[model samples]
Target chain A: MPDAHPPTRREVDVRGPRFAAWLTSAVLAVALLTGSGVLVAVQAAVFAVGALAGLRYAPYGVLFRVLVAPRLGPVREREPEAPPRFAQLVGLVFAVVGAAGYLAGAPLIGAVATGLALVAALLNAATGLCLGCELYLTVRRARPARTA
Target chain B: MLGGALALTALAAWWQRRRDGAVRGADDARGRTTTAVLEGLGVRPGEADLTVVQFSTAFCGPCRATRARLQQLQATRPGLAHLDVDAESHLDAVRELDVRRTPTLFYLDRAGTLLGRSSGAPRPDELTALVEAHVPAPGAREGRDV
Candidate 1:
């Protein structure tokens, strides 16, 4: 199928960093809700403050384009998706994992996993290599098609 | 950057794991260490007298079924084998083969010659006929797909 839209970049799309702050917010929120003691909550608060500080500085995309994406690795071809959708997805996974962990009394692990997922979601937003996208592609590719 | 690396690596690991879980049927993807599809199969082009290369996707259930079926077909048909390559990874190969759908089957004679192809789940009769026609009951024939 034809590309849904024409891509504009150096064979790689450099996305804005609104995603970074969003991820930090998501992770902090999960950590706070899942953590055991007051100290952990304080750490979450510190992260939130840091997130706010970063968000204030020319938005997150500036950080991503200037600092993050560069050090990650070379760009590769990837399909585009609505950016906010990815952020929301990251948030949702973290939230769900956090909740499940709390229920299972393994809140720390769940929260951490959720935080990790958020991190991945955020990175993918900037770099366009999210696990979800890869999963979708791998699943789609594995499923055989039949065309005459 | 560190966070991004972790994220990407986790995704890659998950991808590898998912592929690992796949059985040895259509586009197995598991144990496919090499990026090259043929090398992943642990087979060389010169080893088989006839080869059929199929470009496929992960979500195509029909492709999975076809792969399994093809695996069975290969057991009885010596000198014949198949390779399933991820079309996304090999865009050029897809274009070169003129594949338009998942599980697009490209056939080759014993000499590694591109003999024929089909765009869908081919019938057993069709595969057998193609093999019979191309190989022609053995003159110790040519090689196939690399």
Candidate 2:
């Protein structure tokens, strides 16, 4: 039988690192099937959720995909945890803060944490920067660069 | 997705923070006076910086916020300094920097090179970035006022 699935032309090529990014996102989505007060995984899921929200609510896809289209560039062989990596960092911090505040029964703290995280995330999407990335780079300066 | 929240944040949170007003025409008589007053202190290119000249007028509501933010940013960021020139005192600067908008940020490097400028209320992160890019690294020689 002939191959049922054939390669299709793309407006933006989703190959190489882009493909890895997409696949990792997909896998993360499947793994984070439950929100049940989960942390980092919930945010990875939030991107999926937010992308859908943007599609339905704003008629635009993810904010980064739309605004930073030029920066996304073509997929490469190397996959560095940079953009999503940073998002995960910020999101994880936000999750922890939120969880702690919730556990302590202080909605105010959770709200504050969410507020700050929102700033970092908004800056990333609008200004093409991630605060966590800067934080990560500064902290990891002493560590050896991973060959992987 | 993020933009949506930002849009809401601007409306709900930052709207009150925004100050609005038009730039005034120049007063040549006052321009020279400003330069003499601001010899050592730095200000935005074209816009003279005179700390003595604080610009808080009835017409300019966000003026204080802009000044505070500028002053606050200068504290954390390296070698970034600003001398505030009153929009009223130096109308000539208003004309030179084209301060057609109130609370317009006329940023300059420490030596007075006009690095970049924004004509509205600044985001906190944007303010940090502008300082990082424009401010002289600590211990670096200060260039002449550009």
Candidate 3:
């Protein structure tokens, strides 16, 4: 049989996601600091855009393309988009749960969830390790075998 | 709370630095012949002194870099072979081999014994050291450097 799966053809500069991760970390930090459900909700919307839409359409991604990419040197490396998109979905889940906890007057739950998201975003920003992306791979690997 | 969060993040970063991209001997592959697994993936174990089986997902950036590096190694090393497996499409082999993430590389000798495994992008010097230690010169019939 012909190769069933090929690497994703659409690629993004590695810097794009890293840049977005920095911005995400900052946003998540603020949300955690203020314990603001609204802020968490807003961040959730951002993640929703990235998850439901594509990473290319993410607000921070646009910011990177317009402002950051031009200032930096030419693209050094690129990567497939699926993993980060999956990461955004993961972030969205956390953000939604955090926002719900805050809105429901459960400060501890909100803090914990938002803190987890912040950690993940910070990891991506500082070290280029996407916890969500790693989770994505783990989930895929754990999936049941497709029946032939 | 914020201070606690930052400390936690720092701890995670430190842990990742210590763990990511380092190849370790595969305890799971110890003493087990992987000839069937390799054959299931259509790779013959006898063609080369060593075969590097890399499992990669589409979204993984380091996986691409790993592939390029392995391909480069294959070009330079006379008896080194590289096989790229799409982890998404080959879940069976992935599970059988206990692959956890993209760019998980399995080093196998000619008899299809799993020699080592790396879960992330490997360090260049360490990768070269492992290759030299495992893949003896073709047709020399020398024992492994171990």
Model 2 misplacement above 4 A: A1-148, B1-58, B136-146
Candidate 1 wrongly placed segments (more than 4 Å): A1-148, B1-44, B135-146
lDDT of 3 by residue, B2-72 (tens): 77889999999998788777878755535264546756787766777787877777767677778888777
lDDT of candidate model 2 versus the reference: 0.41
Model 3 per-residue lDDT tens digits across residues A1-148: 1133374666788899899999988998998889999999999999999889898899999999999999999998888887788789999999999999999999899989999999999888898887876766678767788842
lDDT of 2 by residue, B1-146 (tens): 23443465455334334532211233555444444333422333343221212322223323445667767765554355554544444444444444444445544333443333454445667666556655555446455342
Candidate 1 chain A weakest ten by summed lDDT = A2-11
Off by over 4 Å in 3: A1-5, B27-29, B33-35, B135-146
Q: What value does the lDDT take at residue B57 in candidate 3?
A: 74
**Could you tell me the TM-score of chain B in model 2?**
0.51
TM-score for the first chain in candidate 3 comes to: 0.90
Error of 1 at B110 (Å): 2.2
Q: Of the pair 1 and 2, which is ahead by TM-score? A: 1
Assess each prediction's global lDDT (C-alpha) against the native.
Answer: 0.48, 0.41, 0.81
Docking class of 1: incorrect
Candidate 3 positional error at A92, Å: 1.0
Native contacts retained by model 1, as a fraction?
0.02
How well does each candidate superpose onto the true structure, as a TM-score? 0.34, 0.30, 0.89
Worst 10 residues of 3 chain B by lDDT: B137-146
- In model 2 chain B, the worst 10-residue window by lDDT is B49-58
